[model samples]
Target: MQKFSFNRRLVIIIVCLIVSFALMTVSVAVRNKRSTPPLIQQFGNDIVGLTDRIVALPANGLSGSVSSISELLNTYQENQQLKKQVGELAQTKVRDQTLAKENKQLKQQIKLNDSLTDYSAISAAVITRTPSSWQNQVVINKGSSAGVVKNMPVMSGSGLVGRVAEVNKTNSKVELITDNNDSANRFAVQITTKSGKTVNGVLSGFNANSGQITMNNITTKAKISKGDKVVTSGLGGVTPKGLYVGQVAKASGDDYGLSTKLYITPATDLSDLNIVTVAVTKQ
Candidate 1:
């Protein structure tokens, strides 16, 4: 009986709270219904007056319109920037295509020249050259895979350049005629004698600054002079005949044990060998 009484009292309290809340809501609504219509009517009239004044051009909405104008100006600026970028991209693409075409044409020329060459020369590009010193040597873009071997004769259109000394994968080294190696094993060349009649001395490498050749073991009785031509004799099976070495730049020093000293210059410009052809077959 006591539990039933406690439950009934708790239910009564909840019912009372709900009834009070509903009465408060009804009182607020009745007050608003009586006072709100006049306020609404007055606000509508004031909005109409302001809009008419603005349309007549006697009032300014500067502050209200500035944000909209700023947004429009930003949009215009963005569109202009986009147009400029498109133009620049188009111009750059055209320039890139032109450069690519020109580069292809130049490579074709190099390939054609290589094809017509006498020696069995593979195509290669010179990546770099030495500095200061007479770049009597250059590194080519060929190696053992390309049939490049040691002591292969290398040449250009003007004349013989040098021989291959070192070969590696995708690269090879060309030692020019004026290098230290060629000087040691000097060739007593009989040149295409345009310089002079008394030009029958072997040419060897000399100090570059001296700008001369050391022709040793010259027969003392031979009539040798300055500005004479020196060329290969096709003798040692090293260099073939008719390849011009250098003009007899000058003759210097007294007679050695059994040879006279004849100084000479090389025919091919060793310092400036750009493109060269290498004969794979060692002659």
Candidate 2:
């Protein structure tokens, strides 16, 4: 009787398993993703209407949460595009600025060439500088090969900057008036102000190390005051006439002899120099 009862239980379990397997198979067959044509055809009109509604939804400036999500994604993509465009614009701006600087420099060279038509202009670049010496000096690109010889005066649009101190075939050294050995700065300079008072003074380096030059040696006969302009005297024929040197800051002279005092300001800001013109051949 026990063996018969066990066999009956086993039979019942087998029947349950078979039924579950059939149900599973049927469920899988019904839920298969292969064919949706029956449902689509049954609700074709509804599907079309829903599709129109989805297509008509505004992604921006909408009040619904779904619309908000869409707007955010759109805004994010737009921001990324703007950032890329801005980066490209920044690069273009840098290139334009560099080109502008070069153009300005070239225009200046042309102007210098136009101003001095008698002499030939050799375009030389500044290779080195020495500010520690009493006279300031700079090496240029042109040398004996370029026909740039020693003692050739270097001038800018403003006036004389210095002279050629050293030279080789492809290079030359320029001695600025601010150098210790340079004699152009040691002589007396004369300034005729707008008021017509002629002020006489010596121009020299302000310090042992600095390139700060000043107009000293004021004459006693001259009525000197602050803010007076100083210029070259054309005495030694080193630098040409009427080059701006400095402005008078203070004045001190003897009662009968020449007056001498310190000049407070420099006419030119030496630090801002980028381009300068040198006279290769001069009369």
Candidate 3:
């Protein structure tokens, strides 16, 4: 009887296994014939997509805001730079206009192709000036080939500017009267007082701060006053006589009252020289 019971239990176990296999096959076939996934799986996918959009919305907006702010800052900087350039361009234009007007007036005042008493003038343009000695020297387009020689007096549209310091085949260097060096040449200048008295002095140095030349060695008793016209005395054989030098601005006695010192405002605007004349004494 125990042996029969054992065989019956084994058969029951084999029937249960067959029933589980048949159910698994039927479930697989039903899933494959459906057009869409089960409802629970579809709901889970929708939840995942919604969560992704909700998380990315603020992040994308923040990225766009940052890009706009960066572009605005760059544009502001570029606009400021452009404004500065425009301002500079405007200033340059005004300066150029002023220079052109001055140049035209200077040319008219010079009276080209004219002679000054015993000397004939040669017109020349200022070619260059070195920064190292800008107040003391300038280079002219005229040279030895154009009858320019050392110690020859140079004049501007208004009056005397300098003298030829060095001469080359094509160009020459002019030593301005503003030079204050120890070895600088002096001009023998005379002033015509209001009463027609002539007061003589030596133009020795330049006061750079005042933009005036200093004249010394005048007699303390000379009757010199402001606005008196000064001219070359021709005492120095190199520079010709009767060249207009400047006007006396001030006159004062030196220390100990031994001699008089006169400050002269130059006849020409020596600072800005464009066209100049080389006075070549007629042979």
Candidate 4:
């Protein structure tokens, strides 16, 4: 029974092959005789074309999707690179601006040193500053070895900022004018009015809220006005004469009404101290 079944399959295959060859021969003969294909051949061609289109649909769609995904990934990578570059550029710009500002301040200090012909200038970089005592004091890299001594006036940027409070071998602590301590040193400041009258007073305290220095004990009611320039009076032989202190922001009657207390705005930013100059007056 198995042998008969195998023989039947072989016969069916042979018959199909013979029929296919006969059809190919007839198709070629028909094509030579007529411009149009035979109806049977046309039907077979239609079937093959339809099958090819149906098979290619998913393949074409998958190819398009793959291409789109590749393009999307590339674009995302480019965007990330661009963002990194932008961030780096922004950081560089900020650094450059900071450097430029520091350079300008250094130049101004150089000019200040040149103008102080009577006193020798000791330039020092601010080495230490605590947030709690930022306005109160700062430590400089210069010390007693470099002619930095206690009570020497320390100037930053353009004007007087502080005085040497403590001196060490390699460093010194400077007490700023904004120090509110009761034992803080007071500056003998004088303001020259528009009428050429010099009114002298002691810079006693600082108003932290208003960021202004307070001057009390006005010797005479000299009609102090805004924009009046204040300078060191050379009194007590501590701070030198002609050193710029600040400008008068406002003036009001003192507690006893016998004198006026002036609120003076500093010429430079007291909070942002960098390189400072210590005026070595005695030496």
Candidate 5:
């Protein structure tokens, strides 16, 4: 019976609080009609605004982070595409340069063919060079099957380079004029003078350090000059006539001081040999 009386008193107190809050809300609404909202209402609105900002803070931050991540991904994709394009451009440049170089080499071969009109030529590519200090030999792609025989003269774009030393079915080795061990490196060369007289000599030795060939056994009565053009004299049955050797650079006495020696700067640059032609005579 005592608990029932306490519960009845609690309910009466809650009813009285509810009636007091209703009277306060009615009074504020009537004052708002006369002018602006009262200070208490403005205070309530400010509190609601503060609560809304607090609620939205985490949502706004998350939105900004997502947007930044999306933009970063897009930038990365664009960067990758640009890198691929740059790689393709580099490859294209290399291809173009290679083609241009090949074209130039072909043109040179054509010019060489026209210059040697007297003899039939067999074009061959240099396979490899001998790995020696003298650089005295090179292997070519043509051999016995292509009519390339031992002692056959070989010429590059500039002039005579060497002669065939060994031959096989599909390849041959050319012994350059600078070879020290080759006994057959000697050539009968002649220089024509301004007066149409020819001076004969033997091209037998080469000085690697000076890049010059020594022409010894020059006849004492022969007249030659520094700028005279030296060529094969066609004395030996192997080499044909009129093949260019070099220009006379200097003249000095031989080691025995008995005969004259002419030093010649070779017409061909032996350092580089890409393509060559072998003179195939009718013999």
Candidate 6:
């Protein structure tokens, strides 16, 4: 009985499919002949139209999704391109600024060379500074090959900075005037008074806290006053004449009260040095 029921259902399904196919065929034939379709054929045409409308909804949605994905990909590519352009622009700006700074330094060096007509100028760039407790030493890119020698005076834009302490073939070291080592740091300086009388003293020490250099060992009767222009006396041959040192900021007696001491503010900004000129006397 169960097998008989299954067979009956299968036959019913096959008969329904055959009837639907026949109705579609007749509908096509009638439409081609330009005749009105019968009732069954018209029903088949209506069913096909409804099925096409249902299928077209998902097809249209798929096409819209593909278009949105393509647009997103284009947007991502454009963003990446813009980022690359910005990076290139930043690099260009840095290069331009560096060139401008170097040009300004060169022009200043030319002016300094013209003013100091007495000494031959050998321009050198500062390579490094001393990292030890003695911060008064610097290395320059000039050496004996460029005629830089030991005890040669080094000057920046404002005034004297230091003296060449050691010279190699391609580099040299400068001992700044503020060096604590007494034997290598003394300078014979003269202060020009308002009355045209010159009072000479030795620059032997520096006060780091006060930012002043000490010109000590002066005679008790020396008439040194504040605001006097101090310059190299040219007594020793290490530094030449007329090189500006500083002005006398103050004057007082020594710690022992035996001699007078003049405090001077250095003309040059010793904390910052970029380029310097080595004064090499003409042979």
C-alpha lDDT (0 to 100) for residue 86 of candidate 1: 96
Model 1 residue runs over 4 Å out of place are: 1-124, 130-136, 181-185, 191-202, 253-258, 279-283
Q: Each model's TM-score, in the order given?
A: 0.46, 0.45, 0.57, 0.57, 0.57, 0.57
- Taking the tens digit of each residue's C-alpha lDDT, what string does model 4 give over 1-283? 9999999999999999999999878855654454335455545544544455455556656866988898887897899889989999999999989996776688797874422224668998775564585347776777666887678788988799988876665566688998887656788878999889998878889989999999887859578899999998877776777788889999888899887888999988998876899987752
lDDT string, candidate 5, 159-274, tens digits: 88888876655666787887766454587777897678988777888888898988887755666778889888776767777789888899888889888888999999977776
Say which candidate scores most in lDDT.
4
Q: 2 or 3, which is superior by lDDT?
A: 3
Clashing residue pairs in candidate 6, if any? none
**Per-residue lDDT tens digits of candidate 1, residues 1-283?**
9999999999999899999999767645543343222344335534543344445332234533765688786897898889989999999999989986776688797874322112345655554454536546776656666877656667765555677655654456676667764222455477344434433455555657775556666664556666666655655564555565667766566455555666766556666554677654333
Q: Which runs of model 5 end up more than 4 angstroms from their true locations?
A: 1-118
Question: Tens-digit lDDT track for model 3 on 1-283?
Answer: 9999999999999999999999767645543454333455445534543454455446656766988898887897899889989999999999989986776677679964323335778898765565785347876766666887677788897677787766655566688998775545677777889987887778888888899988877874658889998888766666667788888899888767888888999999988876899877654
Candidate 6, 29-128: lDDT as tens digits: 5534532344554455445434544664476567669887988978978889999999998999999899867766886978644222246789987766
lDDT at position 283, candidate 6: 41
Question: Which 10-residue window of candidate 6 scores lowest in summed lDDT?
Answer: 30-39
Deviation in Å, model 2, residue 267 alpha carbon: 2.8
Q: What are the Cα lDDT values of the candidates?
A: 0.59, 0.58, 0.75, 0.78, 0.75, 0.75
Give the backbone clash total of model 4: 0
Pairwise lDDT winner, candidates 4 and 6 = 4
Tens digits of per-residue lDDT for model 2 on 240-269?
Answer: 445566676766553455556555455555
Q: How does candidate 2 fare on TM-score?
A: 0.45
Lowest-scoring 10 consecutive residues by lDDT in candidate 2?
Answer: 33-42
Model 5 misses residue 89 by how many Å?
39
